[model samples]
Target: MQEFEEFIQEKMNPTNIFIKICTFLLLCSTLAYGQAGYGATTDSVYGSSLAILSSPTTLPLSPAPAPSPDYEYVNLTGLLTVAGPFSTFLKYLETTKLIETLQAQANDTDEGITLFVPKNNAFSNLKKVSLSNLTSDQLKQLCLFHVLPHYYSLSDFKNISGSGPINTLAGGSYTLNFTDDSGTVHIGSGWTKTVVSSSVHDKDPVAIYEVNQVLLPEAIFGTDIPPPAPTPAPMVAPDIAPVADGPEVADGGKGKGKGKGVAANSSTPSSSYRITGRNAWMWAVIVPLFVGLIVVL
Candidate 1:
């Protein structure tokens, strides 16, 4: 019996040690959650700010910017302001129907986004083509050739010399050649262009570079916007008429000719839009850690 008791004690010793270590880790995690950094939660006890995990992380996010003001550009003010000199050139994005894709709130991702902007002169050449000659997919391809999968900023490539390939979101890549002349930056590869000025916004979130000359993929010219789709034809119901049981005059002697018909219109209900960007702090980090503790250690 004494040997059995000794064996039981030996087995329980390791269990006690593990519990203490887990307790320590739990305390540290709680402290980390209470931190007041970029993605931290803010309870009054922790003396931090509260926020919804979905919204962008801005420092001192007081008086949140007006939701999508009524300008020509609905949601791309952030992208426009950072791109500096390329500000006017991105107008083609609107004309080419590409702006709708980028400004859409649904496409937030970690892929590095690179935009190769064309100069105004490029558009002048495109205007010569008539719209009737273009296909829907061709216009989409022309605009897509400008976008790259990953984000590359002017500062990231300012010092590098020699030629390298930059891939585009359209499944094509363009070669890049960089030259620095006494502090001025020049970029040339397929098309002639120079970066007049550039700056970074919100840290690594945006890298805007302004350039002279146009960056064409040799595909945009001669292309035109596609025609709008034709409207669908309205549906017609089948005609059904009641048969005359007797002559126009009934056996009762009253003269009858036709019956009155009623027509009713059936319409579908419209859906309402909901307000997003609510500031509710989600406790996503703590829940996972607590669940794992009860499982494999």
Candidate 2:
């Protein structure tokens, strides 16, 4: 029983208990520090990856849209009726149902229409002559006479100038003449001679030129057309005569004057020598008289 008590005392010694406590505390501290360091490293790595993902990057933008084509369907009626005080011309076009044809031509991209728009004053000038006198077909043909089947800009008139008569939409004898005076464009329809007052529209597929007078076709009017005004005559410059050469008699007269001067000079020296001799004779006589007077005294 005494040996058992000694063994129990040795197993439960204070030094061994203290050493076990210290070893357990050191193991716990090492584990906690290792876990904290591992958690901090993991958080730092995750934050770095998140920052890289959240960062913005440049990307290409979409391209701009293309520009529209030059050829476009222009509203002829709206353009004329609104823009121009071409209300009279528009009424004629509408009455003759030619506006649809013009609009159709404007819609065509391949070919275009050249319209000669007469102003309100132009129609008013024709007030004395009633359009009611004409038939429906004649009115349509008259409206067609004002337009050409093809588009012609103000600059394009030069190409057709003096190139003979250009066929109009009326067909047959309904042709017109074009003459370009410098940059100005003049149009002749046999009955009327007018010029383009202004350009209303000059886009592709449509060209409208404002004219001073309404175009009157020879087909409607008789072929007994008036003659064109005569061009004014150019000013005549005065004639200028060339200068004549010097006369032979004048040259001879100058030579004779020179000879006379030489003769006069030759005669002057002889007269001067005679005058000197006389003066010397007088001096000799005076000297002798003076010497005798001195002796008498």
Candidate 3:
């Protein structure tokens, strides 16, 4: 029983207990160090992933959209309504339904139309002839007479100038004449002769020119059309009078006066000396003669 107690005491010794406690502490520290190292490694990997996701990268951009074409339908009625004092012409166009025809031609770009619009004063100045007496068909023909089937710019008139009779929109015997005076385009319609005063609109499909006089077709009027008046002669400039030549009196008189004064001054001294010598000789001979006469007495 004493041996058994000694064995129990030895097993429960403080040194053994201390050694076991130290071993347990060492194991716990190692485990803790390993867990801390693992946590640090995990954090480093997660941070690297976040940095890669946050970085910027280059990429190709998409191209820009293309521009649209410039083709547009022209509005003739709206254009004439806004431009010029075309109210009178617009009235005639509406009255004869020629506006629709002109608008249709304007919509077509291939073989376009040319229009000549008269001003408000033009319709008012139709004194000798009267449009009020005309029939509906005659008025339509008159309105059609003002238009050409094909488009013609102010510059194109130069090509058609003196190119015989041009076919108008009226068709048949309805024709007109064109004459270009320098840059001006003159339109002759048998009864009326006028030039294009200004261009209201000149585009590819349509052209509108302003004229002073209303075009009167010979078909509506009789064939007994009056001849065109003669062109007035240009005024001549007055002739300038010729300038007469004159002598340089100032310089010439000054030189002549200077030369005369110099000659007169030069001769005066010599004449005075000769006259004084002759007078002295006469006095000497007269004094000697008086002394000899006194001695003889």
Highest TM-score: which candidate?
Answer: 3
Better of 2 and 3 by lDDT: 3
Mark the regions of model 3 whose C-alpha exceeds 4 Å error after superposition: 1-70, 226-297
Query: What tens-digit string does per-residue lDDT give for candidate 3 at 89-187?
Result: 788889888888878877754788898889999999887789999999999889899889998988999999999899988898889899999999999
- Candidate 3's error at 50, in angstroms? 41
> For candidate 2, lDDT tens digit of each residue in 53-143?
8989567889989987756569888889777779988998899898988888778646789999999888778743466788999899999
- Model 2, CA-based lDDT: 0.83
Cα lDDT, all candidates: 0.51, 0.83, 0.84
Candidate 3, residue 106: lDDT: 72
RMSD of 1: 48.6
Off by over 4 Å in 1: 1-91, 103-107, 116-139, 173-175, 179-183, 200-202, 219-297
lDDT of 1 by residue, 126-206 (tens): 442532355666555655665555555555555464546554555544444566666665765443355645443323333
Looking at candidate 3, the ten consecutive residues that score lowest on lDDT are 243-252
